[model samples]
Target: MSSKMEKFSVLMSVYHSDNPHYLDVALHSIYDDQLVKPDQIIIVADGELLQTQNDIIGKFISHCPNGIAELLQLPYNVGLAAALNTGLEHCRNNLVARMDSDDISSPDRFQKQITFMSTHTEIDVCGSYIDEIDPVTETFISTRKVPLTHNEIIVFARKRSPFSHPSVVFRKNKVISVGGYPPFRKSQDFALWSKMIVNDAKFANISDVLLRMRTGNDMMARRGISHLKYEIKVLGYQRKIGFITTGQFIHVLAIRTFFRILPGNFKKVVYKIIRKCYG
Candidate 1:
């Protein structure tokens, strides 16, 4: 079989600290899935991993029913963007998928997504909905549906993350064409997606909740003010890119501030309501 038709690279950038606890859930999901065999599960770990890699991941690496896994330990923390870019450099296949250490994917996640991408030639990036599971609280935190249209995605960043970064799959050629992920601020995925869209990259999403994300937004209040600061920065970026005018950006800021001042879960409820109303 052709290389493009045969192999699919799965890039998983993780910290060594994450091992049998959360890592197993993520790896086992891929292993249990019968559809796609990873070309290589490139794990960008740290020096702390070198010792534990042999004990923890070594067995799974050998026994993964589909893919053969490998380890890449960095001397220091290069951050998520750098780690993912390093893995992408080693990817031999045309297709790429992201898997976080903490999320669980549907059994057919890779197979279904790669198949859709194969059928749809125009689209370079595709993401799926997520069943946001708060493992700590042991409660279902509702579902997150990624944007299905280019325009929806542009609007998505203004509120919550439209594309679950770990749930996204894309063509390697297209990702490289846009210069891959940038090591900028906390929003590396945001930066990369914006760059891709600005370059006319086509995006799509599977409406189904094909992944389960471990929700940890309970601490948003501690950094509430900082979160607003990031939104403002992103709005500024939009203005610079000509997506939103200065006046429109300020309008968004005004509405965001108004919502912030409301009672507990008010903004959250509003977002859920908007999803339902729109759906």
Candidate 2:
């Protein structure tokens, strides 16, 4: 089915800390280059953005075809998970394509994902490989590949998140029925995927790069001790919810904690090596 016949909404969230210029590029990537454009783009402002950020979004909305962009503003910074939940609620379509505020979706990102979902009706959630890029220059640093089948995804989820969050297009109702993103600051995507797996949702990957994800020191910094605490909490919840066994949960928790404390520079190097091996 064409995208127009099988409609989907693009859901995104932004906050004060997000770069306005990157946001502009992200919006254009979605609105401009696509075989099939989104029926509606829902952007949830997690909190009050800077005047410049507001202006960037306002200008995009103004130029959008009528009723294409739906902007929802929150009174405070409620973090990504909560903000995304709000955006999900406002989505008018069953299939919602996830996008990050600063990441650029490939021109065929939506087209590919929607086409896959349309054919593989059993796949409740699907994503694709991504090109990790330098946030400032947008230079492709490396590719991140994910498992392509449901069983592989389930096993991979036991060790790491199987899908690139922003590269995914999932069923809104399936996600919501599993309680949506948990109220965590980081690893919210991992948490949600865990819940969905426990709920027996089918998963897959397209095996083609669909998004250019921006990465920088800021992202590595977010992997510090505090974030590790929340990740452990998420892992424990996963174990409790039976998505993972006690042994698998403990093993992953230990490895993740060790990496969390590594120097940001070293962690970046380690990440590159891993991506190369998996790429």
Per-residue lDDT over 1-279 for candidate 1, one digit per residue giving the tens place of the 0 to 100 score: 122343677888777666456676677776666467666677777445645544566777777545467877788888788888888888887788899987888888877787777777787888998887776653677777567876787677554555889999888898898788866546678767777877888888888877888763443323355566666776666567765667888888897666556555665566566555542
Cα lDDT listed for each candidate: 0.72, 0.89
Least lDDT summed over 10 consecutive residues: which range in candidate 2? 1-10
Judge candidate 1 at residue 114 and give its lDDT: 77
Displacement of the residue 85 alpha carbon in candidate 2, Å: 0.9
Q: Least accurate stretch of 10 residues (summed lDDT) in model 1?
A: 216-225
The per-candidate count of clashes, in order, stands at 0, 0
Residue range 202-255, candidate 2, lDDT tens digits: 999998998999985457655788788888888988998998899998899888
Off by over 4 Å in 1: 1-6, 16-20, 50-54, 65-67, 137-139, 154-160, 216-223, 255-279
